[model samples]
Target: MRHAGQRPADMPGAAGFRAAKWHTPIGTSRPSSRVLPSPARVRGPGPAARADRAQGPDRGASVTDLATMSLQQEIARDLQVSASFDAQEEIERRVAFLAGQLTSTGLRSLVLGISGGVDSLTAGRLCQLAVERVRAAGREAEFFAMRLPYGDQADEKDAQQALEFIRPDRVLTVDVKPASDAALQAALAGGTEFRDAHHQDFVHGNIKARQRMIAQYAVAGAHEGLVVGTDHAAEAVSGFFTKFGDGAADVVPLTGLTKRRVRAVAQALGAPSALVLKTPTADLETLNPGRPDEDALGVTYDDIDDFLEGKAVGEAAFEAIARRYRLTEHKRRPPIAP
Candidate 1:
């Protein structure tokens, strides 16, 4: 059988769908987003060097053959060949799929936090389409986009643009600062302060994420809705989310897609270009506004995309990505128990 990454020339795509190209998106992380910068660059073997190493001094395999095999292995292990997928068709399918999942649960509404980021915007549009599909089926459906700002968000403009584009059934802005402050106060009760000043951003950021979840669930329960999440393959592969925070959700519509692919979906779904092309940011840190996700992850999204696509990357990046995948394996799984 052909591997999933292998697409025959005659392979048929989904009805009314055709494969397309990949578009790179910027990656940024906040102190609270838990992303660290990608590993620094280091001198690594070029294609010729890798081919020589693979052939070892005795093998007769051509360098081209070795390189092709290496690329295939990498794609099999990491990348998904996202460009082979049709964005328009996938978005429609996800809309229907989410609708079906919600209908099966006897829930007719969806709730999500909109961060004005591409992931959230794309997922928000999906939610709107899902709800529309459900309603078209003669079932009652609603989509709620909640803006959970910590206080005054510098990037609130982006969030507003997304809200305008999505135009969900309802728009609610809930400042999470009060709740975050309460949680921090409770945690710090009987203690004078945290160990360090900078540590507060981390603690507060986690609080903000969890608080957003709390708000989403509350709204969902009130409206008999399922919580929607925006987690996707790129973030998942790198374990770039917080457990029980943004990670906790009733359903995720954007999983199984790389960050670049997610942007394509956003564009296909009519997401505003400004929103689709907006540099990614976590908006988790209050003091340090606009902290790029790459700065924390120590790697650029381009490299991450390349690594995921099985393209040759620097040695340091390859090792760093591998190490992160291994370390974050636990994040991708359910809690262990005997």
Candidate 2:
């Protein structure tokens, strides 16, 4: 007779099969072999076992896809665009109402950092509108645009374009080469080595950004005006800015809008097409040139914003962003105490 949990030695389909060893709580023993069911009967067959079948393949998207995806995901998912229209209108109305607030607060002028990009251009134009409103209310309000170049000649071109576009009451260009060089020398003296030209380029870029902030604050103080920030919600959420550098401001005019929305609004306001379409760069260079902002960040601003808005940015995209921004996170927020 067969024992418990043991099959018969001459079981069916066991003529050519060898006995297999079995381990139980009692002891180890060999049991008669049994034929196993086919894989299709056990696990079933439906989809192919391929990476693309399981997780979808990403062969890189087109520019239109990238732009549309970013905007749609951020507005629809994170901000809930349908429910946000009223809130957005209210924010615009409040911005218009700031004319009265400025008057009451004894502020007469607005100082803006005109980077010639969509954000800065939008902020400059919006400030111009607010200044007009304030002036209409019998209050003196002026818009001062400063083009502070850290030695990049290409940036000077963009800055000049912005200056021509805005026609601010006062346009000043301050070269921050001396300050940037001093900072670079100090940083390198601390044993921080540059792996290549790109690394050195980034260090110089950070200097340029900080120098521009210093110049903006100085101009704002001199003119006794509120320093307007050009930072938008997308950059804020992903921490894509310099902390006390470009991130510092008295008031951020475009803080509620994403970078994509900023471009839309800028286009709506009739900003220069060339300036609006230009790839953003920190404009830090004394000699050759540097890579664009997207190149340094590994991912585009649109992609970063989309991920922040709760869209599936994919593991590869996320890793690219993490690798880039993780190292520069300190530039995005206030220094924490150890």
Candidate 3:
């Protein structure tokens, strides 16, 4: 008994959606939907296309079209991606914002995990700057740059570099592998087997992420501080974070900026060029360790940044991005209330 002429479960467009293919962009498992041919792929008129539909496709786009697009044209994206800002001004604003958070909440510290990635590294630097500003204002605040690694992370050297750049008040390390592996062992002992090795690796990867966050929260709680996350518009477009793990944060200073914009802020913060431009990756899966984020997304950050920044992108890139944004809406939202 199909409701509303539902297609079979195995069908490409089943479940009321086209079931856009994923290269596991969000650092999670690929969606369960079976392979759908590219040509047969439904080209979702991307954000620009959707926006154009609202006010006659023939009309040229307004300069601020993206910032002011109607709800229907913009529902997929979580934030409006601005083109650029004065890097120093953005930095000062973010530092001041962080300082405000501390002053208003009276929290003694800002705790963030430093993964040696641009996002975390920038946020860590900002956190240090913010705490310093708070202290200058006759208040006490500390920035704790935590290293919650899964045993020995492949990027320890980069992490050290980030630490040197951030110069946080204190640096702490918590090896999350022991705890993460324990959970996996328990699940296996209880007769739980994932679909395959990659599936198991993906699940364990999420465990690692959650454990890392657990460490951050514990440290934050001990010092009466807030957990900071590195989420920004570029990553947000694909929801490229583990839910409740890296995703759950008390504050995100890097919100609404794209990857390139984040790098600009990093430069303003005096980050070394090498660390600022490292290829982004979730680096989660043991099966495909250190997978480049571009590989996972099936699109490049350049394309993502362009689409997010309201520049024209090829149809394929646009569809891939819009699809991820649509699929991962749940990651960005709070739990639904009755």
* Best candidate according to TM-score: 3
Candidate 3 stretches greater than 4 Å from native: 1-78
- In the range 77-129, model 2's lDDT, one tens digit per residue, is 33222224343463465357446546776887888777667678777777777
Best by lDDT: 3
Whose TM-score is higher: candidate 1's or candidate 2's? Answer: 1
lDDT of 3: 0.67
TM-score of each: 0.76, 0.65, 0.79
For residues 1-338, could you state the per-residue lDDT of candidate 3 as single tens digits? 00010111112222221122122222122222322223333244443212112221221232232322232135323364545568898898888888988888888999988888899999899999999999998988899999888888888999999999999899999998899999999989999877667657766777787788789889999998988878777776665666556766778788778889999999988999999999887787677777676665556778777767766665556566666565554444444357
Off by over 4 Å in 1: 1-83
TM-score of decoy 3: 0.79
Give all candidates' CA lDDT scores: 0.63, 0.53, 0.67
Query: What is the per-residue lDDT of model 1 for residues 39-121, given as tens digits with 9 covering 90 to 100?
Result: 32212232111101222121222223344335334432432345456898888778887898778888878998988889888
Residue 78 lDDT (model 3): 35
